[model samples]
Target: GKQITHNLKSRASEFIFYALALDESTDMAGTAQLAIFIKGVDVHKIKKKTETLAALYPLKDTTKLQDLLEAVT
Candidate 1:
C-alpha cells in the first residue's frame, strides 16, 4: 500500500488533456452569445472555465461534464 501510494503521488502531477467547444450567436450587445472552443485542453483550463461559466451562466452543481456533454450533443 505504501509503495502504491508513493507511486500515485509521483504521478499526481501528470499532464492531462480535455476539450471544450461552445458555439453561440448574439446581436446588439458585444457580449451576447459566446462560443468556446477547447481542444486538447487541460485540467487548469477546465476549472477556470467552469467557475466562469457557473458565475456567468449559472449551471447547477457547478460541474463541467454536463456542459461538455451538451456541446457534444
Candidate 2:
C-alpha cells in the first residue's frame, strides 16, 4: 500500500482525472470486479500502472479502491 501510494504521489502530475467502475453480481455466489479509468496520462502508462498495482496489491473492497483513486488523482 505504501509503495503504491509513493509511486502515485511521485507521478501525480501525469494524472488529470480518475474514475472507477465497480460491478457485482446480484446472486449470492456472484463475484465483483473493479475497473479504473484515468485521464491525462497516456493509456499505455495507465495500463502498466494498473496492472502492476493490481499484481502487487489486489483490492477486494470498493472503498479501498476508491481511496487509491482519490490519492492518485
Candidate 3:
C-alpha cells in the first residue's frame, strides 16, 4: 500500500499528454469507449510549468475535440 500510495503521489503533479480515441465497442452495445494514452517526462520541474500555463489560461471546452487535438499537435 505504501508503494502504491507513493507512486500515485509522485505522479500527481506530472504533466501528461493524452492521445484519446473514441469509438463504439464491438459488442453491439450502443455505448462508446474512450481510450487514453499518456506520455511525458517524469520530472517535477515540468509540473511547475504546467501550473503556470494553467493559471494563465485555463482549459475550456469551446472547440470540437478534433480541432483541439489538431491545435495541440
For this target, which candidate reaches the highest TM-score against the unseen true structure?
A: 2
Q: Deviation in angstroms for 71 in model 1?
A: 18
Record all residue pairs in model 3 with backbone atoms less than 3 Å apart, i.e. clashing: none
Q: Score each candidate by Cα lDDT.
A: 0.37, 0.40, 0.34
Clashes of each: 3, 0, 0
Model 1 vs. true fold: TM: 0.22
Q: Per-residue lDDT tens digits of candidate 1, residues 1-73?
A: 3443343333333325533345454445443333443344234554432211211222223235665344333
List where candidate 1 sits over 4 angstroms from the true fold: 1-15, 27-34, 37-73
lDDT of 3 by residue, 21-63 (tens): 2222222443322222334444555553222111111123334
lDDT of 2 at 19: 35
Candidate order by TM-score, highest to lowest? 2, 3, 1
Could you give me the TM-score of model 3 versus the true structure?
Answer: 0.24
Better of 1 and 2 by TM-score: 2
Better of 2 and 3 by lDDT: 2
Worst 10 residues of 1 by lDDT: 49-58
Error (Å) of candidate 1 at residue 70 is: 24
* Least well predicted 10-residue stretch by lDDT in candidate 2: 50-59
- Backbone clashes in candidate 2 total 0
TM per candidate: 0.22, 0.28, 0.24
